[model samples]
Target: MFLDNEDKISIDRVVEELENRPELQHVYLHKLFKRDHHKGQRYHEKQISLYAEYDRPNLLPFLRDSTHCPLEKALEICQQRNFVEETVYLPSRMGNSHSALKMIMEELQDVDKAIEFAKEQDDGELWEDLILYSIDKPPFITGLLNNIGTHVDPILLIHRIKEGMEIPNLRDSLVKILQDYNLQILLREGCKKILVADSLSLLKKMHRTQMKGVLVDEENICESCLSPILPSDASKSFSVVVFHCRHMFHRECLPVSNTVSSVQFCNICSAKHRGPGSAVLEMKK
Candidate 1:
């Protein structure tokens, strides 16, 4: 039900019913109202006190005063209804998960409102339910990220991991959400390291021209046939070697063949090398 658009329920009647309803006596409406903003609109404290005393069949007129409440605070009231009623938990009252999900999907016609609602759910189960409902709906994620981008905010998916929840999958789902928004770079750099059997040499060549190649750390020895020295230990050959064009690489790590005929770019920087036979590897120190 789009409360703002279609649900014509009067606020006053609801408040009246709430006052007479024994289930709501323990619900401290005052605490919630105190924490929220009412803007510049004046509200009489006396009115609330008197209104609370009314046990009438209809009080829509008094409740209609909520129209003056700020949008965020008004939203909180609607969400509180979900918890107050608790009828949603009854399969007969609100249907099973599938039916409830379908109903939420229909109600989420307003992306902004839906996202606001999503943020209010501190429970992981509710978040999972919302995500499952949104799986087929692309707007859910798109709208969520767009809201974050616009507001420069982050989604508080789960306040904290709770017992009985699939912890690993929850973390992975969060990662997927970050990646989908192209925001994974927010994570640590070490985690992004590319690992491959031959990645070291390939990276050396690729970055040659783009940077001043200098291998600071070298480890392990090649189990392959060891000539004068092992290829894996190449990084330990020289402290540093400067190329003719001023490019540099670890002397030990230099390719045994020193083949550069097809290599047109420096290993560190992408500097174009048109010089004869590529610069010779000369010692820097």
Candidate 2:
């Protein structure tokens, strides 16, 4: 019971007959559009409106097959329906509309556009991907570092370079980044060395003073034991060792071995003691 050229029924009556049969609807509509141009435009518009109202799933295919359906109208309907995935395929049906193509590219994760968008938006995660992608390309990394150095985490960047050390192509770039990073560390260490040297010089001067002598109430005190070295203590005189620095200490207090060496320097001033090897001293009154 198909409608044909021989049928005397009006197009409205034929369409009404096919309304209940979805399988035959497309066939009848396609034939009607091919046969009667005026009626076809009316039927196409009516189908577009009905699809927009109740058949969003079939809207794209309907629009694609209909001669009178506008691409802009399809895009609008997709937007209204929030059909993001469907929009991706709309460009092919619409002969590569630029906006549709861009939407599809973005949805498909176009690397170049992703990087560009990330840079524009200052997105760290996307920049990280771009950085990893440029690992083997030194020139690109140099440019990337120069451009985004302030925005990126330098510590993370350093860590990335360290991990890239095994890559032969990345070696030069890694070295350059490391050199700049280490230069600051070296300068900091250099300053620490200078401070240490200054402290050591001050400590040496104080040590020299301690070795020279300690005067207590017009009396000389032994530096090691802080005891008075009285000239009147003749009995204990043999128990003392005086260094060339003019400091005296009990022989037991001084770090000396049973074997006398050719020269023994004061532990404090580090100066060699000058005199007889083991001569008994006679103090002047």
Candidate 3:
């Protein structure tokens, strides 16, 4: 019989057509499952059970889409078919998907998996939820703090716990968790201080190098007036100023400034000028 391509086709007629052809039963049922989860699931559980082993993979998608399918049931299917990672909506609508996966991992008593999921999410609120839920379980708390405490901000969680204080029974355990958090913070600050000190030391060394003066060489000449500074005329009335780069210029030929020390830069290379004599000049000022 030819089927009309009409939108008004009843679900009963569609099912009857698939019933006449057993080969198309799973495919049509899956389509119906996608359309109406409640009825489709009922048919899937009853009629689809015959081809379940061969058609399980096809059935998983329908189960994943079915609102009637409980998270526990979906998880069981995932475990049986090893499709946990493949099913994106395995958590259902109870909570955030990642948080729900974390809960599932926790239920399975897979602490590492739950911690890894929590870290991947990088949500402070989710981490806090995991912390609050696992508080009474000392072993789980220890593992969480050891693995992820440094990666997340414990201060926020601590503040939350302090505000509520509902779980006063676990106060000592909470205090221990805070101690680990404080230790992590202290180590981080210590590292920053060390980095700052090293940076300052390196900067001081660079400054000293930039300010150190060198003796004038044969090629050294005054840049301002293009005059040669002769070593034989060193004792002459014309005073010479040797810059950090060995570029020499007559003091009178230097840039017009208040004092020699005030002339903080070279007239030749523009390098900063400094020496024992520059300090003496500053003292004279």
User: Which one wins on TM-score?
Assistant: 3
Which residue pairs collide in model 3, if any?
Answer: none
Ranked candidates, highest lDDT first: 3, 2, 1
Off by over 4 Å in 2: 16-39, 49-61, 89-96, 108-285
The Cα local distance difference test for each model comes to: 0.41, 0.57, 0.58
lDDT of 1 by residue, 1-285 (tens): 212322474434444556666334313333233334242134333233333344222122334444353333322343454422122212212225443333455643555554454454334454555555554445564554444332223354333223454443444455656664565454434354644535887867755753554332333221122222223454554334444445555545556544354443445555555433334433433
Q: Write the per-residue lDDT of candidate 3 for residues 1-285, one digit (tens) a residue.
A: 212333577556777776757657666666556555766555555433433444666655655465565556555555566555534345634456564656455556766767776777677776777777776665565566556656776554445434443443355655667787788789999999999999999989976875665655446566667766544554554466655455556667766752346446764455664455542122100
Model 1 residue runs over 4 Å out of place are: 1-105, 144-285
- The best candidate by lDDT is 3
**Residue 247 deviation, candidate 3, in Å?**
5.8
What is candidate 2's lDDT per residue for 142-241, written digit by digit as tens? Answer: 5554445345655555456644344434555455556766776888899999999999999888656645543323277666787765545555444556
Better of 1 and 2 by lDDT: 2
In candidate 2, how many clashes are counted?
Answer: 0
* Candidate 3: Cα lDDT at 274: 49
TM-score for candidate 3, please give it: 0.41
